[model samples]
Target: MLAEQTIAPDHPVFAGHFPAHPVVPGALLLDWACHSLGAGQSAASREARFPRSCGPGSRLVLRAEPGKEPPSSARRFAITTEDAGTEVAVVTGTLGPLSTAAGT
Candidate 1:
Protein backbone atom coordinates (compact mmCIF):
# COMPACT_ATOMS: atom_id res chain seq x y z
CA MET A 1 0.00 0.00 0.00
CA LEU A 2 1.29 3.47 -0.94
CA ALA A 3 0.27 6.80 0.50
CA GLU A 4 0.66 10.35 -0.85
CA GLN A 5 -0.90 13.78 -0.32
CA THR A 6 -0.35 17.17 -1.83
CA ILE A 7 0.13 20.09 0.55
CA ALA A 8 -2.20 22.77 -0.61
CA PRO A 9 -1.31 26.39 0.01
CA ASP A 10 -4.20 26.48 2.48
CA HIS A 11 -3.26 23.33 4.37
CA PRO A 12 -2.83 23.55 8.14
CA VAL A 13 0.83 22.65 8.12
CA PHE A 14 1.40 25.40 5.60
CA ALA A 15 -0.59 27.80 7.73
CA GLY A 16 2.02 27.64 10.51
CA HIS A 17 4.98 26.86 8.26
CA PHE A 18 4.42 30.02 6.30
CA PRO A 19 1.70 32.50 5.58
CA ALA A 20 2.68 32.71 1.96
CA HIS A 21 3.59 29.76 -0.26
CA PRO A 22 3.77 26.65 1.86
CA VAL A 23 6.47 24.04 1.92
CA VAL A 24 6.02 20.49 3.09
CA PRO A 25 7.87 19.71 6.29
CA GLY A 26 10.57 17.07 6.17
CA ALA A 27 9.12 15.26 9.17
CA LEU A 28 5.72 15.06 7.57
CA LEU A 29 7.20 13.70 4.40
CA LEU A 30 9.20 11.14 6.35
CA ASP A 31 6.15 10.02 8.24
CA TRP A 32 4.13 9.78 5.06
CA ALA A 33 6.80 7.69 3.42
CA CYS A 34 7.20 5.49 6.46
CA HIS A 35 3.51 4.88 6.72
CA SER A 36 3.22 4.25 3.02
CA LEU A 37 5.97 1.70 3.34
CA GLY A 38 3.88 -0.02 6.00
CA ALA A 39 6.84 -0.52 8.31
CA GLY A 40 4.50 -0.72 11.27
CA GLN A 41 1.98 -2.93 9.49
CA SER A 42 4.65 -5.61 9.30
CA ALA A 43 6.58 -4.30 12.26
CA ALA A 44 9.76 -4.13 10.22
CA SER A 45 12.73 -1.84 10.53
CA ARG A 46 12.46 0.96 8.02
CA GLU A 47 14.37 3.96 6.69
CA ALA A 48 13.38 6.83 4.42
CA ARG A 49 15.05 9.93 2.98
CA PHE A 50 12.61 12.70 2.26
CA PRO A 51 14.87 14.77 0.05
CA ARG A 52 12.06 16.63 -1.63
CA SER A 53 8.90 18.45 -0.71
CA CYS A 54 5.61 17.71 -2.43
CA GLY A 55 3.12 20.44 -3.08
CA PRO A 56 -0.66 20.12 -3.01
CA GLY A 57 -1.81 17.18 -5.15
CA SER A 58 1.71 16.14 -5.93
CA ARG A 59 1.92 12.54 -7.09
CA LEU A 60 4.07 10.29 -4.97
CA VAL A 61 4.83 6.70 -5.83
CA LEU A 62 5.71 4.63 -2.77
CA ARG A 63 6.89 1.12 -3.53
CA ALA A 64 7.79 -1.67 -1.14
CA GLU A 65 11.06 -3.38 -2.05
CA PRO A 66 11.32 -6.70 -0.21
CA GLY A 67 14.33 -8.95 -0.61
CA LYS A 68 17.79 -9.82 0.64
CA GLU A 69 21.33 -8.42 -0.08
CA PRO A 70 19.68 -4.97 -0.19
CA PRO A 71 19.27 -2.88 -3.31
CA SER A 72 22.80 -2.23 -4.46
CA SER A 73 23.98 0.00 -7.34
CA ALA A 74 23.02 3.61 -7.90
CA ARG A 75 19.47 2.74 -8.94
CA ARG A 76 18.28 0.23 -6.34
CA PHE A 77 15.68 -0.30 -3.68
CA ALA A 78 16.66 1.48 -0.46
CA ILE A 79 14.25 -0.46 1.76
CA THR A 80 14.37 -4.20 2.37
CA THR A 81 12.86 -6.75 4.74
CA GLU A 82 14.63 -9.85 6.09
CA ASP A 83 11.50 -11.98 6.28
CA ALA A 84 8.17 -11.76 4.50
CA GLY A 85 6.18 -12.37 7.71
CA THR A 86 8.77 -11.67 10.39
CA GLU A 87 7.38 -8.16 10.87
CA VAL A 88 10.98 -7.09 11.19
CA ALA A 89 12.58 -5.20 8.34
CA VAL A 90 16.33 -5.48 7.99
CA VAL A 91 16.89 -2.27 6.00
CA THR A 92 14.97 0.55 4.37
CA GLY A 93 15.80 3.95 2.89
CA THR A 94 15.40 6.32 -0.07
CA LEU A 95 17.69 7.78 -2.71
CA GLY A 96 17.31 10.55 -5.26
CA PRO A 97 17.62 14.26 -5.73
CA LEU A 98 14.03 14.80 -4.61
CA SER A 99 13.58 11.31 -3.14
CA THR A 100 11.34 10.29 -6.04
CA ALA A 101 10.44 6.65 -6.54
CA ALA A 102 12.77 6.54 -9.53
CA GLY A 103 15.68 7.72 -7.40
CA THR A 104 16.97 4.22 -6.82
Candidate 2:
Protein backbone atom coordinates (compact mmCIF):
# COMPACT_ATOMS: atom_id res chain seq x y z
CA MET A 1 0.00 0.00 0.00
CA LEU A 2 1.00 3.64 -0.50
CA ALA A 3 -0.22 6.95 0.80
CA GLU A 4 0.34 10.65 0.20
CA GLN A 5 0.82 12.55 3.45
CA THR A 6 0.77 16.30 3.84
CA ILE A 7 1.32 17.26 7.41
CA ALA A 8 -0.72 20.37 8.06
CA PRO A 9 1.32 23.51 8.61
CA ASP A 10 -0.83 24.39 11.57
CA HIS A 11 -1.27 20.94 12.99
CA PRO A 12 -2.00 20.98 16.69
CA VAL A 13 0.98 18.78 17.45
CA PHE A 14 3.18 21.81 16.90
CA ALA A 15 1.88 23.47 20.05
CA GLY A 16 3.90 21.54 22.62
CA HIS A 17 6.24 19.36 20.55
CA PHE A 18 9.16 21.77 20.49
CA PRO A 19 7.62 25.17 20.02
CA ALA A 20 10.91 26.56 18.77
CA HIS A 21 11.98 23.75 16.48
CA PRO A 22 8.91 21.62 16.01
CA VAL A 23 9.02 18.22 14.43
CA VAL A 24 6.48 15.46 14.19
CA PRO A 25 6.52 13.15 17.14
CA GLY A 26 7.71 9.63 16.50
CA ALA A 27 4.58 8.09 18.00
CA LEU A 28 2.35 10.33 15.89
CA LEU A 29 4.38 9.50 12.81
CA LEU A 30 3.88 5.80 13.54
CA ASP A 31 0.18 6.37 13.96
CA TRP A 32 0.02 8.16 10.62
CA ALA A 33 1.91 5.38 8.92
CA CYS A 34 -0.33 2.75 10.47
CA HIS A 35 -3.49 4.55 9.48
CA SER A 36 -2.40 5.10 5.91
CA LEU A 37 -0.84 1.76 5.06
CA GLY A 38 -2.81 -0.40 7.46
CA ALA A 39 -5.78 -0.18 5.11
CA GLY A 40 -7.83 0.67 8.17
CA GLN A 41 -6.98 -2.39 10.29
CA SER A 42 -4.60 -2.24 13.22
CA ALA A 43 -1.33 -4.14 13.26
CA ALA A 44 -0.86 -7.27 15.38
CA SER A 45 2.81 -6.37 15.90
CA ARG A 46 5.33 -3.94 14.47
CA GLU A 47 9.01 -3.00 14.47
CA ALA A 48 10.29 0.34 13.22
CA ARG A 49 13.34 2.50 12.54
CA PHE A 50 13.48 6.28 12.36
CA PRO A 51 16.35 7.34 10.20
CA ARG A 52 15.53 11.02 10.21
CA SER A 53 13.17 13.71 11.42
CA CYS A 54 10.00 14.92 9.68
CA GLY A 55 8.69 18.41 10.12
CA PRO A 56 5.24 19.83 9.65
CA GLY A 57 4.10 21.25 6.30
CA SER A 58 6.13 18.69 4.44
CA ARG A 59 4.86 16.54 1.60
CA LEU A 60 5.62 12.90 2.28
CA VAL A 61 4.87 9.54 0.76
CA LEU A 62 4.32 6.38 2.74
CA ARG A 63 5.07 3.05 1.13
CA ALA A 64 4.48 -0.49 2.41
CA GLU A 65 5.20 -3.98 1.18
CA PRO A 66 4.72 -7.48 2.58
CA GLY A 67 7.66 -8.64 4.67
CA LYS A 68 9.82 -11.52 3.54
CA GLU A 69 9.35 -13.50 6.75
CA PRO A 70 6.76 -16.18 7.37
CA PRO A 71 3.06 -15.92 8.38
CA SER A 72 2.39 -13.26 5.72
CA SER A 73 1.45 -10.73 8.41
CA ALA A 74 4.86 -9.16 8.32
CA ARG A 75 5.34 -5.94 6.34
CA ARG A 76 8.05 -3.49 5.40
CA PHE A 77 7.43 0.18 4.83
CA ALA A 78 9.04 3.62 4.54
CA ILE A 79 8.13 7.28 4.57
CA THR A 80 10.07 9.76 2.48
CA THR A 81 9.92 13.31 1.35
CA GLU A 82 8.00 13.50 -1.89
CA ASP A 83 10.40 15.96 -3.48
CA ALA A 84 13.73 15.20 -1.84
CA GLY A 85 14.39 12.00 -3.77
CA THR A 86 17.02 11.33 -1.13
CA GLU A 87 18.59 8.16 0.26
CA VAL A 88 17.12 8.77 3.70
CA ALA A 89 13.68 8.04 5.09
CA VAL A 90 11.94 10.33 7.52
CA VAL A 91 10.60 7.19 9.13
CA THR A 92 10.57 3.54 8.17
CA GLY A 93 9.26 0.45 9.88
CA THR A 94 7.27 -2.75 10.01
CA LEU A 95 3.93 -1.02 9.96
CA GLY A 96 0.93 -0.49 7.70
CA PRO A 97 -1.46 -3.01 9.14
CA LEU A 98 -4.22 -4.87 7.32
CA SER A 99 -7.01 -2.88 9.00
CA THR A 100 -7.93 0.28 10.88
CA ALA A 101 -5.11 2.01 12.80
CA ALA A 102 -5.11 3.64 16.22
CA GLY A 103 -6.17 7.27 16.98
CA THR A 104 -8.62 7.12 14.15
Candidate 3:
Protein backbone atom coordinates (compact mmCIF):
# COMPACT_ATOMS: atom_id res chain seq x y z
CA MET A 1 0.00 0.00 0.00
CA LEU A 2 1.03 3.58 -0.63
CA ALA A 3 0.33 6.51 1.67
CA GLU A 4 0.84 10.17 0.99
CA GLN A 5 1.31 13.24 3.20
CA THR A 6 1.74 16.91 2.44
CA ILE A 7 4.10 19.03 4.52
CA ALA A 8 2.31 22.17 5.61
CA PRO A 9 4.33 25.32 6.11
CA ASP A 10 2.40 26.23 9.24
CA HIS A 11 3.31 22.98 11.03
CA PRO A 12 4.14 23.84 14.65
CA VAL A 13 7.58 22.21 14.61
CA PHE A 14 8.83 24.56 11.94
CA ALA A 15 8.58 27.48 14.36
CA GLY A 16 11.41 26.23 16.53
CA HIS A 17 13.34 24.28 13.91
CA PHE A 18 14.02 27.49 12.05
CA PRO A 19 12.31 30.82 11.76
CA ALA A 20 14.08 32.05 8.63
CA HIS A 21 14.31 28.78 6.68
CA PRO A 22 12.12 25.98 7.93
CA VAL A 23 12.71 22.32 7.12
CA VAL A 24 10.89 19.13 7.99
CA PRO A 25 12.50 17.17 10.81
CA GLY A 26 13.79 13.65 10.15
CA ALA A 27 12.01 12.25 13.22
CA LEU A 28 8.73 13.67 12.01
CA LEU A 29 9.26 11.94 8.71
CA LEU A 30 9.87 8.61 10.45
CA ASP A 31 6.70 9.06 12.48
CA TRP A 32 4.80 9.59 9.29
CA ALA A 33 6.24 6.37 7.88
CA CYS A 34 5.17 4.41 10.95
CA HIS A 35 1.74 5.98 10.88
CA SER A 36 1.40 4.98 7.28
CA LEU A 37 2.14 1.36 8.13
CA GLY A 38 -0.51 1.26 10.87
CA ALA A 39 -1.32 3.22 13.97
CA GLY A 40 -0.99 0.25 16.32
CA GLN A 41 1.97 -1.40 14.60
CA SER A 42 5.49 -1.33 16.03
CA ALA A 43 8.87 -1.92 14.48
CA ALA A 44 10.92 -4.75 15.92
CA SER A 45 13.98 -3.56 13.97
CA ARG A 46 14.44 -0.90 11.30
CA GLU A 47 16.67 1.55 9.48
CA ALA A 48 16.07 5.01 8.03
CA ARG A 49 18.33 7.33 6.09
CA PHE A 50 17.57 10.75 4.63
CA PRO A 51 19.27 11.84 1.47
CA ARG A 52 17.89 15.37 1.29
CA SER A 53 15.92 17.90 3.25
CA CYS A 54 12.20 18.15 2.75
CA GLY A 55 10.87 21.66 3.11
CA PRO A 56 7.34 22.78 3.81
CA GLY A 57 4.81 22.26 1.02
CA SER A 58 6.58 19.14 -0.08
CA ARG A 59 4.47 16.10 -0.94
CA LEU A 60 5.69 12.74 0.35
CA VAL A 61 4.72 9.23 -0.67
CA LEU A 62 5.22 6.13 1.45
CA ARG A 63 5.16 2.70 -0.14
CA ALA A 64 4.94 -0.59 1.74
CA GLU A 65 6.39 -3.86 0.50
CA PRO A 66 6.58 -7.37 1.88
CA GLY A 67 9.86 -8.53 3.34
CA LYS A 68 12.04 -11.09 1.55
CA GLU A 69 12.31 -13.49 4.47
CA PRO A 70 9.94 -16.41 4.53
CA PRO A 71 7.04 -16.84 6.96
CA SER A 72 7.69 -13.44 8.48
CA SER A 73 5.12 -10.74 9.10
CA ALA A 74 7.62 -7.93 8.86
CA ARG A 75 7.22 -5.31 6.14
CA ARG A 76 9.51 -2.75 4.56
CA PHE A 77 8.52 0.73 3.52
CA ALA A 78 10.05 3.61 1.64
CA ILE A 79 9.09 7.25 2.02
CA THR A 80 10.00 9.63 -0.73
CA THR A 81 9.41 13.11 -2.12
CA GLU A 82 9.79 14.09 -5.74
CA ASP A 83 10.93 17.31 -7.39
CA ALA A 84 10.73 17.74 -11.15
CA GLY A 85 10.40 13.97 -11.39
CA THR A 86 13.50 13.45 -9.25
CA GLU A 87 13.28 11.70 -5.90
CA VAL A 88 14.25 13.76 -2.88
CA ALA A 89 14.28 12.55 0.70
CA VAL A 90 13.94 8.79 1.15
CA VAL A 91 13.01 7.25 4.51
CA THR A 92 13.11 3.46 4.77
CA GLY A 93 12.10 1.16 7.63
CA THR A 94 10.53 -2.15 8.68
CA LEU A 95 7.37 -2.80 10.65
CA GLY A 96 6.60 -5.42 13.23
CA PRO A 97 3.39 -7.45 13.42
CA LEU A 98 0.07 -5.64 13.48
CA SER A 99 -1.75 -5.49 16.80
CA THR A 100 -4.48 -8.07 17.06
CA ALA A 101 -8.04 -7.08 17.77
CA ALA A 102 -9.53 -7.53 21.20
CA GLY A 103 -10.66 -11.15 21.93
CA THR A 104 -8.88 -12.38 18.84
Candidate 4:
Protein backbone atom coordinates (compact mmCIF):
# COMPACT_ATOMS: atom_id res chain seq x y z
CA MET A 1 0.00 0.00 0.00
CA LEU A 2 1.10 3.54 -0.65
CA ALA A 3 2.10 4.88 2.74
CA GLU A 4 1.94 8.55 1.72
CA GLN A 5 -1.64 8.56 0.44
CA THR A 6 -2.72 6.59 3.46
CA ILE A 7 -2.51 9.60 5.82
CA ALA A 8 -2.54 12.61 3.55
CA PRO A 9 -5.22 15.11 4.68
CA ASP A 10 -5.79 16.70 1.27
CA HIS A 11 -8.38 14.08 0.37
CA PRO A 12 -11.49 15.78 -1.08
CA VAL A 13 -13.93 13.51 0.74
CA PHE A 14 -13.24 15.17 4.07
CA ALA A 15 -13.99 18.67 2.80
CA GLY A 16 -17.78 18.72 3.13
CA HIS A 17 -18.14 15.77 5.48
CA PHE A 18 -18.23 17.97 8.58
CA PRO A 19 -17.45 21.64 8.12
CA ALA A 20 -17.60 22.67 11.75
CA HIS A 21 -15.78 19.75 13.35
CA PRO A 22 -13.44 18.85 10.43
CA VAL A 23 -12.90 15.45 11.96
CA VAL A 24 -12.23 12.43 9.76
CA PRO A 25 -15.06 10.08 10.66
CA GLY A 26 -13.88 6.83 12.18
CA ALA A 27 -15.63 4.73 9.54
CA LEU A 28 -14.24 6.87 6.72
CA LEU A 29 -10.71 6.47 7.93
CA LEU A 30 -11.08 2.75 8.26
CA ASP A 31 -12.70 2.51 4.85
CA TRP A 32 -9.81 4.38 3.30
CA ALA A 33 -7.45 1.89 4.81
CA CYS A 34 -9.48 -0.91 3.31
CA HIS A 35 -9.35 0.83 -0.06
CA SER A 36 -5.58 1.00 0.09
CA LEU A 37 -5.79 -2.72 0.00
CA GLY A 38 -7.59 -4.63 -2.72
CA ALA A 39 -11.32 -4.11 -1.99
CA GLY A 40 -13.02 -7.21 -3.28
CA GLN A 41 -9.94 -9.29 -2.67
CA SER A 42 -9.07 -7.53 0.55
CA ALA A 43 -8.79 -9.81 3.54
CA ALA A 44 -9.05 -6.87 5.95
CA SER A 45 -11.58 -6.35 8.68
CA ARG A 46 -11.81 -3.38 11.06
CA GLU A 47 -13.08 -3.09 14.62
CA ALA A 48 -12.59 0.39 16.02
CA ARG A 49 -12.67 0.79 19.75
CA PHE A 50 -14.36 4.15 20.13
CA PRO A 51 -13.35 4.77 23.69
CA ARG A 52 -13.85 8.49 23.03
CA SER A 53 -15.28 10.46 20.18
CA CYS A 54 -12.86 11.71 17.59
CA GLY A 55 -13.72 15.40 17.52
CA PRO A 56 -12.90 17.94 14.83
CA GLY A 57 -9.26 18.48 13.85
CA SER A 58 -8.46 15.16 15.43
CA ARG A 59 -5.91 14.37 12.68
CA LEU A 60 -7.12 11.10 11.27
CA VAL A 61 -4.76 8.20 11.68
CA LEU A 62 -4.58 4.94 9.69
CA ARG A 63 -3.81 1.80 11.60
CA ALA A 64 -3.49 -1.55 9.88
CA GLU A 65 -2.39 -5.06 10.71
CA PRO A 66 0.14 -5.12 7.90
CA GLY A 67 -1.33 -7.99 5.88
CA LYS A 68 -4.66 -8.37 7.61
CA GLU A 69 -7.86 -8.34 5.58
CA PRO A 70 -10.20 -5.35 5.55
CA PRO A 71 -13.41 -5.29 7.53
CA SER A 72 -16.96 -5.57 6.22
CA SER A 73 -19.43 -2.70 6.20
CA ALA A 74 -23.22 -2.58 5.92
CA ARG A 75 -23.19 0.29 3.43
CA ARG A 76 -21.63 -0.14 0.02
CA PHE A 77 -17.99 0.89 -0.06
CA ALA A 78 -16.24 1.81 -3.29
CA ILE A 79 -13.99 -0.96 -4.48
CA THR A 80 -12.07 -0.61 -7.73
CA THR A 81 -9.28 -2.41 -9.49
CA GLU A 82 -6.57 -0.20 -10.94
CA ASP A 83 -3.26 -0.83 -12.65
CA ALA A 84 -1.67 -0.90 -9.28
CA GLY A 85 -4.31 -3.24 -7.95
CA THR A 86 -7.80 -3.24 -6.42
CA GLU A 87 -8.79 -0.43 -4.10
CA VAL A 88 -11.76 -0.23 -1.70
CA ALA A 89 -13.09 3.22 -0.90
CA VAL A 90 -16.09 4.76 0.84
CA VAL A 91 -17.04 2.00 3.27
CA THR A 92 -20.43 1.78 4.98
CA GLY A 93 -20.71 4.46 7.62
CA THR A 94 -24.47 4.11 7.88
CA LEU A 95 -24.27 1.44 10.51
CA GLY A 96 -25.38 2.42 14.02
CA PRO A 97 -23.20 -0.03 15.94
CA LEU A 98 -20.05 2.05 16.01
CA SER A 99 -19.82 1.70 19.76
CA THR A 100 -20.18 -2.04 19.45
CA ALA A 101 -17.73 -2.19 16.57
CA ALA A 102 -15.31 -0.30 18.76
CA GLY A 103 -16.09 -2.52 21.70
CA THR A 104 -16.79 0.48 23.86
Please provide TM-scores, in order, for all candidate models, with all chains considered together.
0.46, 0.77, 0.76, 0.35
Residue 96 CA error for candidate 3 (Å)?
Answer: 3.4
User: Model 1 Cα displacement at 72 (Å)?
Assistant: 14
For candidate 2, which ten residues in a row score worst on lDDT? Answer: 95-104
Give the higher-lDDT candidate: 1 or 4.
Answer: 1
Residue 18 of model 1, lDDT score: 54
C-alpha local distance difference test of each model: 0.43, 0.71, 0.70, 0.39
Off by over 4 Å in 4: 6-10, 39-46, 50-63, 66-104
Question: Candidate 2's residue-wise lDDT over 1-104, tens digit each?
Answer: 38886899799999999899999888887777667654444463366777788787887777888778754656788888744555458877775344422322
Runs off by more than 4 Å, candidate 1: 41-51, 70-104
Per residue, candidate 3 scores C-alpha lDDT tens digits across 65-104 of: 8767632556777778888988865666665554411212
Sort every candidate by TM-score, greatest first: 2, 3, 1, 4
Q: Which stretches of candidate 2 lie over 4 Å from their true place?
A: 39-41, 82-87, 96-104
**Model 4 alpha-carbon miss at residue 30, Å:** 1.5
**20-49 in candidate 1: lDDT tens per residue?**
756566566555555565443222223355
Candidate 3 residue pairs that clash: none
Candidate 1 vs candidate 2: which has greater TM-score?
Answer: 2
How many backbone clashes can be found in candidate 1?
Answer: 8
lDDT (10s digit) by residue, model 4, range 1-104: 23223334555656786666554566665556555544432323433334334333233333233322233332222221222243323222222134434544
